[model samples]
Target: MGILNKFLEKTKICVIAEKYSVAVEYAKALGCSKKDTYFEGDKYVILWTNGHICTLYQPEDYDEKFKIWKVEDLPIIPNGFWIKVRPGKGQILNSIKKIIERQEITAVCIATDSAREGNLIGEYTLMAIENKKNVYRAMINALNEKEIKAGFKNMKEDKYYKNMTLAAQARDEIDWLLGTNLSRAYSVIYGKKYYVGRCKTVLLNLLCKREEEINNFKQSLSYGVITKFKNDNCEYAGRLNYALKSESEARSIVKDICNKQGKIDSIDRDIKSIEPESLYNLNDLIRAVNRRYGYAADEVYDIAQKLYEEHKLISYARTDSRYIKKSMINDVKLIVNCINIDKFSMKKSDINNIERFIKRCVNDEKVIEHTAIIPLEVESLEEKYKLLSTKEKNVYDVIVENFLNNFLENYEYESIAFLTKVENYTFITRQNKVITHGWKERKKQDKNIVEVKEGEYVNVEDSVVEKKLSKPKERYTDDTLFEVLENPAKFVEDTKLKKILRESGIGTNATRALLLKDLIINGYVTRQQKYIIPTIPGIELVKDIRTDKLLEPFFTAVIEQQLQQIQDGELDKDELIKDTIKFLERHIEELKSIVIPDKNNDPIGKCPICKRGNIVRAKDKGYGCTNLKSTGCRFFISKEILGTYIDEKQVKNLIEEKQTDVLRFKGSKGEFSARIIWNGNKTQFKKF
Candidate 1:
């Protein structure tokens, strides 16, 4: 008997949270006291529901109404949808219901996380089982045990989360209603698998637009003048952007400029060093890790999720806040001190000095509920670090090292720019040098310089006029791609649409990385080195939808606004879904009228299997299919479903010679391996 049950004798309560651990954590805090606890004395019981114990029943689950995408079903809306304990979670549901049936239980307390999903979990569970018990809700933002206990101590009526529940219900039913209908409609019409969600479709369009930019890129030529001059001890290089039509013209100008005395027209210098970076948000961390190491966003997400859930070193890895909360200041300092002691081996006095400096820099207003990602405890991180693979270890090092440096002193640097003018030619040189290494002292940093201003006369040592060609537009890496996705205005020229995109979370942090991987795996894009380049099919898809709003970033942004409204209590979720449906209907009709070709017609390639048909790529599978016979030969190569990218050359080799030149691949189960060739068939694996 907990303390709360005695004070509120007739009330029953339930604790629902996003994860089992969260619910259990909150429950422990309250139940620790016997008698008069939140529920025991009140004759209340705490029932827990897993995250999304029930979802809007699938379309096929509603038979006769299925496969028809018409407005007559306008709200083909269910008066109420059927709910069941998720098929595999019978044990959990049974346990909850068993507690609910207890003799003394009189009221229900809803202690879910204060989020949309949390509300839905409790609501659907009650409705499904036909439990009409009186319910009260308790909401709190933090996951700490103290906060949980306090929230129970000062409980709010369940009616407080009613609107939130409505919002969640709306989101679920709408996604079910719109996603199912549109997906079916398109899949039927196009005879291909396609899926669209309020947010995911917009993300797809963003990628398609990027592919368009890359494919349509036209390379051009431009000229720059480079000169190498020697001073007393060293040689320096400077470049002049002298617009010239040809290399010969550029060389002629260089010759004329070098002949005259080079005088320093202007010398500008400023010295400053970069400070250590603050903690990273999910996006910032993803971008940095992607650039510094070739860690894919999805791979990094996996690493981060592990760091949070399994290792328990980082707090809530999916957050967007880059600043730590005021309450976390002391904890942050302690972490910094521990890192300096364990990893960097700084003396206690030095650690204390750095800690004081870090403490001084703390600001409360900058943080939200959760702080930027830093290790909660060094032991957890170090233990996990030892078990990680080489790739995972490198990424972990980035986070650990960054955590160490965030508390360190600032770096100082000197920057100098000298301008020289000779016979109508302007030469510019810029140089930057480190004055105080600061953070750079611990980590090697890359720098480039382009000037030497020792004395008056500039010495010319060497000169070259090489022909230069324009470069194609760059492709998306998991890093740069999000910038374009999250803030489309930066890449787009449309003024109105950009404003709309800025307000929406282009892709939720949880889903953004997976979407990138999907685009590459689907033959919509290809990876060249570390870059994500679009394929021919992707280019064609973009061309087909170039002018459609459904294919643009703004579409996703608008939906995001509605989602936010749902969260903010400004809009009912059902209305948002209805609006989304109506919007999609109009959009899909317009899209159907446009002339879009079949998959094969986009950019047909010779089939490597039969040499009689074309190769086709689809969502679930990619293979060479011969349309000549009723049953065609399907030589399929899955997109990372089974293995890494198997290119056209590999496909060609696989079929023509019956052996695939020892197909090397990263194993889904273990390390890298290759298929050994034997008598034109596959044989044993050779380990790497």
Candidate 2:
């Protein structure tokens, strides 16, 4: 009876935020001073979730047959997708479940991030708890006091975001259906671990195609005739439109034009207006930082997230929108006023036009789930800047600069084009002169002008024929690759397909960087300075699977489009899942007939005992003598020595030097350090 009374005295309202930091902020605003894993107030209890408390079940979770890799089990599509509490999250799940089950708790508030993934997180948590209470969504962009309060005051029913949850679930199930079945089939046929994904495979195909083009490219020599002309103490340069294939042809033209008088046939001048660039989305931000500071995409993302969550100096960073909502104009103005532009290296005149620039960034239709990443209205800008790391500071400065440019005037310039004729050949020269600095204060353009009037005669100061060779297309850097991934249609040949692909990119802005990181981690690609180059395995993988539908970027785009339709309520979720299953079943049969070529079997080293058979990699084992059956040489080494898996490089080192470098191993007692020594018949460890 006492326990029942205690349960009856539970809180009326429970709020669940996505992360601990966000929950703390919300708790402070909701008058919850006392704290534990959750903060308790008189009428409300504020709890936090660690990202996602639940995830889709793994393949083995569906059935025991999935434990082994077999071609027969090609398409493992479950009748219904099952949800499981992610490992290490059971305790939190139980706590939240108990709170939800409490009879006194009348309503629940989902104060997670304002995006699809956030909606999925909250909905999945509720589903895991088997919640049936009234659920409300507190959609707020930042974790500030004002926004949090406003979000609570204007909470919407959880059913409003049901479509978003369905979309997210569809994406997960589709990726699983394709990735799990295809990865296992290829790995089994090739005898190596080959992990595949829709986005990752398409990205790999792009890189491989580019690599092939680069490899097959042949350099061809070409010659150009360049001449310098002088008129009225001003000099200008021009190149002939035609490029000669032979040096003799170029020399003949240069000789004919040398020391000759040329007349300007026409001179055209026009004012060119350069508009300010759109604001930075996540993909654009990643590209900008990578190009400027050589920072990886993940590193920049982490820094941006820190700036948003810790410093509260910027809006949400994981956004794809480049424009703010029309309703945010007043808030944007406040943010602009809060920025101390005097501390930045900017002209006072540029600062005066802040209002005008701010108007350019406002567009209701352009805004998506979140607004563009802009500086927030903080109390002390200088103090926040000081607290940021080098990379964070760099990213903050970029956002601030872009925000300021919206208020500045357009960059104005004048282009002057001159067509000079000597004999029958025509040479064209062009120049640009800046009329107004405007946004160019941050990004300056080259201005090199030479005054020349129409029909004016000029002497050819000098003429030269230079021979050059055409180079292959440069390799993809992080900056360029991000752009391609964002808009893959730029490389597509078909006009209709390109238009469709541009609408739905290879991956979302939030996940494109992760896809690249995964490719590098999976040995599909390597980084050579700034460029991404495909490895031998990557090249072969592309060659082996190029003809399959899985390598088509458009196919992934179609899947993404259907998910978007699900979000918009234009398509039914069950129908989408059924279609995916049908597609997978058709492909799995086609995949079985294709023969995967065996990889090159490189011997580790010559056997020490027999000295006849070479040491080769043993299936699911470490290494073994190839003549074990022929010559009765039963020499083999286990993959794991002292509870640590030995890699190929370490195995080779042990065979050649009789010992490996210092290695760490975890035993039954505890983790210990040692060097693995290759004994004649067996291996032993020497403590380091």
Q: TM-score for all predictions? A: 0.73, 0.84
Instruction: Score each candidate by Cα lDDT.
Output: 0.60, 0.80
lDDT of 2 by residue, 1-688 (tens): 2212323455467889888888888878878875657887865788888899999888899888789989887788787888999999999999898877877788898888787788888888998988988888878877678877878877777788889888988888888888888789778777678888888989998887776565445557799988999977678889887788899998898889889999999988999998777888889888888888888887888888888777778888899899888777778768877787464556434567446655677777877678888888888877777877877888888888777777778889888888999999999898888888787664554655687778889999998898787766767888888888888887668887797788888888878888888989998888866778776567657766634466778888877888889999999988988987887787778778778543225688888789888888777566888898899998787766553446567778887888887665546675456777878766788863
What's the residue-level lDDT of 500 in candidate 2?
71
Displacement of the residue 586 alpha carbon in candidate 1, Å: 3.0
Model 2 worst lDDT run, 10 consecutive residues = 1-10
lDDT of 2: 0.80
Residue range 1-688, candidate 1, lDDT tens digits: 3435544544445554556555545656666223221223233344455566766666546666655554334334455666666777676666666667665665566676455666788888777667766666666534545456666776665676677777667667766766675655555555555554555556555655554443344545667788776556556666774556777788787787664556557878898868766667677778889989978888898888766554545666766666665666666666665553354554223333545345634566765334566666454445656776776666666666666666566688788888766567777777777776665553456465545443467667666775676544455687888767667777557887677777665766656787777766766666666766555555444444423454666666776667767766798776876686677667666546555456544323555546577656544345445553545665455433223344445555555554444433434453233543323322334432
Find the candidate with the highest TM-score and give its number: 2
Clashing pairs in 2: 357-406, 357-407
